[model samples]
Target chain A: MSEKPYVSVENISKWYPYKGDKLINHEKKFIKANDDINLSIQKGEILGVIGESGCGKSTLGKLLTRLETPTAGDCLINGVSTKELIKNDMKAFRRSVQIIFQNPFDTFTPRDTIEQILLRPLKNHNIGNSKEERRKLCIERLEEGGLVPGEDIMKRYPHELSGGQLQRISIIRAMLLDPEFIVADEPVSMLDVSVRAEIINMLLDLAKLHNTAVMFISHDIALTRYISDNIAVMYLGKVVEYGKADEVVNNPGHPYTKALISNCASIDPDDEREEISITGEPPTPLDPGPGCYFAPRCFMACEKCLKEYPDKKNLSDTHWITCMNAE
Target chain B: MKNNRLTIAAQAVKSNRQLMAGCIGVLALLVLMIAAPLISTEDPTIYGPDVLNGLGENGHILGTNHLGQDVYSMIIYGVRTSVKVAVISAMISGILGVLIGGAAGFLGGKVDVIISEIINVFMMLPTFFLILLIVALFGNSLTNVMIVIGITTWPGNAKLMRAQALSLRERVFVKSAEAMGETKRQILFKYIIPNGIFPVIANTTLGMANAILTEAGLSFLGLGDPSIISWGQMIYAGKQYITSAWWICAFSGIAIIIAVLIFYMLGDGLNKVMDPRYNKRRA
Candidate 1:
């Protein structure tokens, strides 16, 4: 890895205006979708982000891809802030970063054929010299996406293809630009279980061959562990735990991370272990009171946890936990 | 081989008996209009010696009016005039509506509010009276009538296109295009317009029918160009001699009714066939 991270997210936060009851004269509210998130990824690194729905995992992906602007802080690409890069060189910024959406079927224009969909990004970024050259490049990228005989699929429309086929085409479309960083937001969660492994493998292989950094967001802990070098666990729009993948999974420091690991479904029949299930939902993001957001649901909740939010406590050179009790 | 658009349209027309009937009627009328010179014995405006002649008199199949002009020939040629005016006017209005509505719906926010308010203002006023006022003030020439009718009839279609564009703007594919760094023009024309255009196309046929009716109404009210021989003008000319020449008014009225009905049926069939929801249901 190089001395400088390829993409760095520095204390970024995103909030949305929340409309309260019209009948009441209450103050305007805001939902803290992402709260002071900090992370970075080097070249050829895959950082897995695991969180339940509404935990701001997708919001973070949007922030990194510049699909949505951060309400506070900034994300740096190669040491330059994204806002500056966008203002100065928007086309370059777009070419450098791409996103793979969750729902493959909805990602493509229904009127466009597979060839048109794949050729668009290359054409937009002016990647190839001529139309004929771009056509060849598209075919090669589709093959890299594991879709054999790309020419046959090119003539077909989105409705004609299966979910898995469309998804592979989407991945190929993102890769056609030769982007530096990609944010795959639950890319395979919408596909069938049988096809999920194939897609994941193809994605990882492509990322490796391209030497591209990726932020793979998913709710599946086992899958994240298999593909990611490092994992960040999020709860209620906050990163409750951050560390190496195996360390976070095997030696979970935060209580929420431990509960998440135990919650992972196992197939072993003879193994007997006590499952730690957190009760009650995470508090609503609207105007959440001070202190730990997870204190209400944490089994080890204490007076200090309810009174003040815990700061990051480093356990090792690479592992960090945000819980005071964990130290 | 996969079915192309033309083949699918042909199949759609063939499958529905009412649509087939409507197509056949409109096709026959169109042929008659095109072959009017060959089929007519004499120019419709040329006066003859036989005045107020009954049907089949002096070889005039539909008889002669008070001016001794052949009513059958007049009706045949009037088809050409009516179609020309309706088509031109509908095209003008359709283009204008789609442009305004598509821009409003896709751009949204303040643009939407402004355009929508303008459309509402137009919609609230009586459209027919507005057309009449414009034509009356501009002098009722054929071109003036067509332009006035075209301009007055666009607000409704604009509202429809705007609604479609609004929904289409939110589709995931549009966002995907934006994320790919596509320009605003590319997204609007390539993605938004093509997807939201079916309703506009379907509405255009209805607009043509409405334009035909409006033109006929104007001609009946003596607001039509004096030089043109339209079905409405025929009825207006024959009304003074109604007791003696009922065929003149009745036949022209029938022609107008048939033309408008054919367009309405075409619009209805197009709405069903072109609708994606309908296609999904069939699939």
Candidate 2:
């Protein structure tokens, strides 16, 4: 609250036109992927975003990277509006903000060797003087990402490597720009359980080393709590809970965040956490009327919760929940 | 300097002399193919007492082969056969490749699996030998050679288009382009086809040249249509008198080389014209 944020998202709503609905219709239906989303990250801080599939976590990541523009509002990086930056200084904006995609395999072009992929960003960004210097940088970055024998891996194609290796390479590629902010959109979701920690730790350490603000998105709340300074839990298209990771995990205010936390598999043998069961699937994003999106699935849903949507209710100076019914 | 690349490229093509040679050579060959009868009234099939005539002896222009058939008339006439086979077969293969490979790649799932398997199978078979086998079985008529070459050579183009289409559809720009309201056909033609078709196109020129060479090989082996006096047939008819009438094979071989080389140059020039990278200005 005291320090000015390095990266701040200001009520950016990304509502995709519902493909099943006709675009020519006067009242075009929308799948609100991220609606009035607000969050901020300090320099070198990791903001973990935990949400289930189709909960707009990836959409939020895309918005952060300016891959898909928001339908309304803007994201600010170092106080420069990303939306306006697109027209005026898009190349610089791209250099400052990078995204690590979920699918490591698809992120890379198959035809290009790993070295070419590493060198391209440098070439486009004009990082090195000559091809040789750029290539050496590529090798150094690859080794830093824990891919040993960088020279060997650089010459090989994406198909030649493991998913974990490719994911590491993807991180290395993103961080190669020495970005001001990065969105690691489920960087380890597709990876094996053993290597997930390695990748996450690598990202965290690198972000800290570069003083890079990061939006670490994943469905695993426990893991998010482990890596993030702040955690924002998304449901449908809205952030249901935003707080310190420990604050949210220890005392989840929103029914959805509690539900998400309850579903996590604990490592402790004596763990006796109660699983809070809620009813019904998420209603279609196309016509999510006046009520809260989680109201139908919320265990604590009441008549008021069904009839009206709620706004953020402060828990502490830095913690808040969107549910009005929370104690 | 900041002008549209395409407009500049159009101007560049107009001014490029190498491209001009290719176009002029192609144009001259087309004229030869179309105006063979008008240019020379002498029947290329007819043999006379003007045997083994060397380079304009006894009123024959290039010379006569073992049959005393005027090599000049025969070569001018051979343009029709050589160019026709190449053009027609190249079209057939290109069309076949785009359709099959495009469907397989764009459709995906069962269609891709089946079509890709077929492509792999086709790739395994040596294309030239396959064409030879088919021509041998079905009888080596001009039409048959053209059709066989067309069918056998298409798999390479199909494989390329398939790989390109598969990869292109997944590209970030292409996906965003599709999302921004371009119709499938428009995207296919504009984004997909243009990107992928270059490899297919590059393959096509080689295909045409190979077709010419294959036809020559077939004729040398006495498998071509006996009625037409093609360059290959001319070569065949002159092989027996190699020492005395070296001009017969030499001239026919040279004509073949010129034809093949022109096709290559034409293809290379056209490739340059279409490629966006060619718009770069020299210092």
Best by TM-score: 1
> What shift in Å separates residue A163 of candidate 2 from its native position after superposition?
1.2
Q: Rate the local accuracy (lDDT) of all candidates.
A: 0.88, 0.82
Off by over 4 Å in 2: A21-27, B1-283
Docking class of 1: medium
Model 2 TM-score is 0.64
The sequence of per-residue lDDT tens digits that candidate 2 reaches over residues A152-258 is 99988788899999988888877777888888888888889999889888988898899998999988877889999999999888998999999999898888888
Error of 1 at A221 (Å): 1.0
Q: After superposition, how far is residue A193 of candidate 2 from its true place, in Å?
A: 1.1
Q: Clashing pairs in model 1? A: none
Positional deviation of residue B216's Cα in model 1 after best superposition, in angstroms: 1.0
Q: Which pairs clash in model 2?
A: none
Name the top lDDT candidate: 1
Error of 2 at A123 (Å): 1.1
TM-score of each: 0.94, 0.64
